[model samples]
Target chain A: MNIAILGFGTIGSGVYEIVNQIQAEELKDCKVTKILDLPQNKDKLDIIVCDINDITEDESIDLVVETMGGIHPAYEFIQNCLQHKKHVVTANKAVVAAHMSDFLKSAKENGVQFRFEASTGGGIPWLASIQKAKRIDEISSFYGIFNGTTNYILDSMNTLNEEFETALKKAQQLGYAEANPSADIDGYDVQNKVTISAALAFDSKIDMKDFPCFSMANITYEDIQYLKSHHQMIKYIGQAIKKENMYEAFVMPMVFASNSLEANIPSNFNIVTLNGNTIGELKFYGQGAGKLPTANAIVEDILDIKNQISYGKVSLDKKLSYCNTLLKEKYLIRTNCPIENEWIDSVECKGANYYITTKAISTKDFMKLVNSISDQKAMIAKYM
Target chain B: MNIAILGFGTIGSGVYEIVNQIQAEELKDCKVTKILDLPQNKDKLDIIVCDINDITEDESIDLVVETMGGIHPAYEFIQNCLQHKKHVVTANKAVVAAHMSDFLKSAKENGVQFRFEASTGGGIPWLASIQKAKRIDEISSFYGIFNGTTNYILDSMNTLNEEFETALKKAQQLGYAEANPSADIDGYDVQNKVTISAALAFDSKIDMKDFPCFSMANITYEDIQYLKSHHQMIKYIGQAIKKENMYEAFVMPMVFASNSLEANIPSNFNIVTLNGNTIGELKFYGQGAGKLPTANAIVEDILDIKNQISYGKVSLDKKLSYCNTLLKEKYLIRTNCPIENEWIDSVECKGANYYITTKAISTKDFMKLVNSISDQKAMIAKYM
Candidate 1:
């Protein structure tokens, strides 16, 4: 099985190394024949190719592994590979979340497989697990700490008593967070992940825009202290639920009890859970993202394609209506100007901020309330 | 695909219900055609059969699901089914731990597949996850609370300040523990589970006798309180490590910090972990033993077989020596017997008991020391 790795960056190179390191009998014939990367950045690799056509046009390349972490060309290259009758496996959440339906259609039309196990929970086998469970059970809901960078920041702030900025700086220093970490801190990373996961779990195509997201960017030390005083800890959570005929998907910084599994998840680790009708709740925990970990997941997908391990077809055939207003929960709001609302159950004026606890309110209403507030520094967290 | 179920018990009935509930396209042809059980136990189900040959000789049955939960007839029935060219799926850990290698050989010789995803961590997809990871990475170690009954007892004792007997009674009342309770409390249940998991994780056949087990039956409230004072909690842990040329597997009550994931696992939930060379640590948590959950796992295997989704072959071909002496850890011991050893780090005498904390000691040495003590009430726990 000849393989081509797109983007010889951290994850792509890691996949090449793991493909070489595989000692399993069934995967012995697997080999990386081509690597698509910038010519100057190719380093010492002889297999490096600067053109996507070098991979897609090669009839001998049985599979293409996309590790390029973006939407545009990765999606186009994947589609091209599928059109050329080559199976495609990827770790790019952005590409998967944006164009999964189109990729699935292309793969089906070309009679190939398109797998992205590393897209949602990196290295956790979460997406594959959901696919496995879906074979016999209906997945009603799934939610988790989806982003490693945001989890690291929140965990450090809670455990080490570091300020939000201090933890964010540390995360950036460790490479867990990038220089411009808006995609992670502002919930877009988790938004992309939850969108992909929800599509698989509920068997329905979920528009990323339909999944409302609340940023953990503005969370402060005072907010953490208040939550801790109430015996709660905050974690950036991405959740999706299958209601009667509707699906609710969102990402937010939610409160969990101190002893809950979500609260105890330390550092950059992620814990994603799926609620299966018959199997009950199953939680998968591991390194959500890393070079070797993410690469390991991609390798698993590659082997599955090589060995003809049918994950069946990628189907988002369910037609559940996307609705965000059906789910309701109390939220903690910290702001300088909260004005007034019927949902405000209690308000505590502390220093320059008014810490208000709202009654059970739908996510849509809460988003509207937050937007209506004039205070730009206002922060909100779901009390789960 | 016509299916035969051995033993019309909790798991068997659950499997029957789930098989009928499956809405997937590929599994729509599956039907439970026969059930092997005692004559008097067959109630309202016309598919129930009294004799094993009724299933074995019937060529219409394409698969057999064994949920008999024991070592004797269940093993024999599975062997017969495989020999008759029918795929076998089971939820019996005892039989799998005792005869997995033989079953694998039988299935291979008969050109059938034998899968037991529910054998180890009931409904957790633990073995399946290990197999998935093993495809690309070498699994180095695996450990966790494999027995849900013991976890419930320990968790209740810690959180609710319940006595050992009280917790055990509650577990029994809730059907988590058997009337005998020895399999769960004496560590045999975990011993069997670890043996099965270690075999898959390391690709080596391990004897149940090689995996030493320390009973949690003798643990008292005092032991829990003492550990609590040190900010530690007790959990019955089963661990297996792949050494240079040997494997070390054991089951014992171990101490973890209160904030650890192992400590926060409440009620009857089980959390099992596997450390792969590339993927690092992956933890699977869920209902370790329940009718619906375990049955759901069995149905997954059924679907895999129905869809012709090959999990590759189960090969216990690796030849590794089993040694229990290499791993070392501190131990907390409570006993009335006089103990004098170089490994004793500290001794605090409470009312009628000497609470001894040992230095880093091999499991072999610790077991020998505990055996030498005549006090039948002696309790030991590993500090990790």
Candidate 2:
């Protein structure tokens, strides 16, 4: 089987190396025949193609792996490949999150498989596990540290008592975060992952924009110290819970007990969890994002296709509505203007900051209250 | 597809419940047609069969789920079913650990699948995950808390300051341990699981008895307290590492940092890890053994067969020998007898007990020295 990789970048080059180096019977006949990238980025002379049609038009190429890491041309190219009856495997979460339903529909109509195991949790076999689990169990909820960059920053702040910006800069130096790191630190990366996970786990179509995401960019050193003093530490998490026919999905910085699993997740590692009816709660922990790890997941999907191992079909037929008001939890609010509220359980004043602990309140209500305030520097975290 | 259950126990009943309750497209036509058990244990009159031939001879029964926990008849019955070209799914660790290679051989000859996902980490999708990982990466080593009963005992001893016997009794009351409790406390259960895991991970046949297993039964409350004071906690773990042409595998009580993931694994929960070439380290945490959880795994295998999803073939053709002297670590020894050796780093006498810490020494050397002593009450643990 001939394979083509879109974008000869970090993950794409790693995929090419693994496809050529792995000694597996199923992957023995598999070869990277074409690479879609700019002329200057070409490492191999024989297989470089700047146009998508050059590879899509070739009937010999049976599979396409997308590592382009964008939504625009990657999504259109994936749709074209599926329409051509070619199997598609991707590590792009943004495209999968935005066009999952459309891609599934196209793949179904074309009788091909569209897999994105690397789209969430990096090297962790999370999507395949969830698909297997859904065969015999009902997945009611899932939540975890989906972004490695924010996790690194938060973990560093807690352990080394470093400021948020200092930790983020360190993460940037280590290549864990990009120079323009708003997608990761501001919770957009986690939002995309949460959308993909919820779609697969709950069998429902979810819009990434519909889910409210609270940024971890505003978390300060004082907040981490205060939470640590209270036997808790902060972790940026993307969580989705199913309540009857409604679903509540969001991304926020949450406080966990110092000794809990979430707090103990050090460095840039991630821990994702799923609550099943029969299997109970199962957690998958590993490197959330990296070149080789992410490439390993993409190769796994390729092998699955080669061995005729189908994860069945991607069907989001479950009619579940989104409602953040269905879930309620206590919140830790740090702001300059918080004087009176019935939900306020306790309040502490430190210099110019009013740190208030609110009683159990709906996420929708809390976000509404926070948005009503003109203080853009206010930071809110959930109590886990 | 008609299915036959070879036991009417905890896991067998769970498989039946999930197979009937799961609303999946692939399992729509799958039904439990026969159940082999004694007449006194019959819960359903229409499907119960006392003889093995009642299941093997039935041409309509295409699959057999062996939940009968033993080596004798369970092993023989599984072989018979495979000889009859029936796919077999089992949760019996003892049978799988002892006759895994033989069962794989028989299943291959008859063109059938022999799966034991629940034999290692119950409901955690451990074996399946390992198989998927092996398709693309070289697994070098794996280790974790494979036994929940022993973990519960050790955790309770550390957290509640309960004696070993008291914790064992608590485990029994919660149905986590059997009446004998010998298999769990003596590390035989973990040994069996490690054997099965190593066979699948390294593609080599291993004997459960060949690997050394240290009993956690001798651990005392004072040992837990001493370790706690040093910022460590005891956890019973089964580990296997590949070193070129040889492999080192063992079951022993090891100390981990207090804030580590292993130390915080409370209650009867289990955590297993695998180290892959590309995926780095991935940890799976969940209930290792339970009625519904184990059964859920069995049903997952059954569904795989129904959907024509294969884990391919199992071939333990890797010519790897077992050796224990290649790995080295420090040891904490507490005994009534005086110990003197070049490896000893420090020693302190507390009444009639001698608490000694040894420098890095191979497990083979430490065990040989411990066995040379006539004192049967001596306790030793490895420092991680």
Candidate 3:
């Protein structure tokens, strides 16, 4: 089958190499017919085509792989490919987070498959593995450390006892984080991933704009030290727990006991755990983001399509509203300005700043209180 | 579909409970038609049948569930069911380890599927996950902490600073260990699991008798403390690493740095890691053994069959010769009588016993050296 790759960048080139190098039956006889890239970037590669129409207009191209990560053209290109009766696989989390339902509907209508295994949790096969179990087991909830860049920075900070700035610079130097690292450090990357995961896991569309994401930018060495002193390790987590009949999805810093798996997740490795009612907590751990790892996940989707495995039933039938106020939880809050509040049941003054661990309170209410407190050094983390 | 269950014990009854409790579409119309058991064991369960012919002769029985744990009758029973053109799903590791190739051959000849997800890693869905990746990636090797009973005992011994016998007694009290704990304590259980995993992961039959298995019974508090002093933690590991053209499969104690993931695996949790060529290290972790967890895995297999997801092509095409002489590795050995050996590069006399850590040596040669020094009191562990 002839396949075209959009954006011959890191992940795109990796996919091309794997399809050419791997002798497995799933990838055998498969050829990359065209690689859509910028005209100025095109060089010795004969398959590189600047025009997107070269791929969408080609009738021989049975599949299109999109590695160009953005919502605009990637979404349009993927939608066009699905409409043109060509199967589509993508590693773009933004497009998937925003337009998954539309893509699924278009693919189903056009008698094609739409797979985005690489979109979330990079190489971890998070969505596809969960989908397999979803065929029989009802997933209650899932939580994950989805962003590799942020995780890398956090791990560096803890391991080297360096502050957040040093760690971020190191991650940037290592190509783990972009120069403008707001997407990762500000928690938007993790938000997009968890939103996509929530959509598939709960069979609902969680709008990216609607989901509240808490950033790790404010996470300080003092906070980490305080957590360490309390025998807890801080991790930026994306959790989607079903309470009553609604789903509560959020991205925030949560502290787990020192011995817990979440606390011990080292370096940039990603761990997404689905709590299935029958299957228990099944975890998928691996390199969450990398060129070849993400490319490998994309290939898995291609093989799934090749083997005539129908994209398991997914729908935006229920628009799940993000609700974090369902259950009460213990929280660790550090603020320099907080002098009085009913939520602050207990407070320990570690120097000038107060380290307060509140009683079990709804996350929404507590976060609201946290948001209201405006100080240079105010930070909040949950004790889950 | 009418299903017959052989051996209505812990896992069998748990399977029955799940099939009855879960209202999944795949198990909707499925009914337990007959349950085979010993004459004296037959009681209030109305579906119990004394004669094996009751299940084998029933043409309406479309599937058979085997939870009978043994090599003799369970293996024969599964082969007979396959010959009768009935799909079989088993939780019996002994049977699967011994006759996996034969069962697969029989299933292929009779146009039936043989699945034993419960046999290897209890509830982790390990083999199924690996098979999914094997479709697209070439896996090189895998290692796992497979047996929960032994893990529980080891964890207890380490955490509570208890002796081996005390930990064993506690494991027994918790129903994790059997009265005849030889299978688990002797490392035979891990051997059986790794053998089955090797057959699937490598597409070759790994005979239990051919593989070398080192038991946990020889491990003492002193051994644990000695390893701890060196910033290492001891774990019983079943490893199958491929080198050149052969596979080296063994069950033994291995030491990892204190901060490594293997060292942090707490309680009875199981971790199985597979190294794929492109995907890097993928890990599956969950409750590896329990009545309900094992039963849940069986139900997963049943659903796979119902969905017609062919048990991904597995072949005992080549009988893998176990050879541990492929690569050289570091080892820590404690012996009552060991003074002269060229391989021993470092020695520390902890007490009356000599703690000798050897330089890199092939596993086969190292084990041979260990065997020679044994007054049945020598303990050896690999440093990985």
On DockQ, the leading prediction is 1
Candidate 3: Cα lDDT at B160: 84
lDDT of 2 at B253: 88
Clash pairs for candidate 1: none
lDDT of model 3 at residue A331?
79
lDDT of each: 0.89, 0.89, 0.84
Docking quality class, candidate 2: medium
Candidate 3 local Cα displacement, residue B269, angstroms: 1.3
Residue-wise C-alpha lDDT for candidate 1, range B224-332, written one tens digit per residue: 8988888888899999899877988879989899889999899999999999989999999999989999998898888888777765667788898887687888998
Model 1 gets an lDDT of: 0.89
DockQ of each: 0.76, 0.74, 0.66
Q: What is chain B's TM-score across the candidates, in the order shown?
A: 0.97, 0.97, 0.96
**lDDT tens digits, residue span B303-353, model 3:** 778767653677677656678688789988887876578888898888888
TM-score of 2: 0.97
The single-chain TM-score for chain B of candidate 3 is 0.96
True contacts kept of each: 0.86, 0.80, 0.65
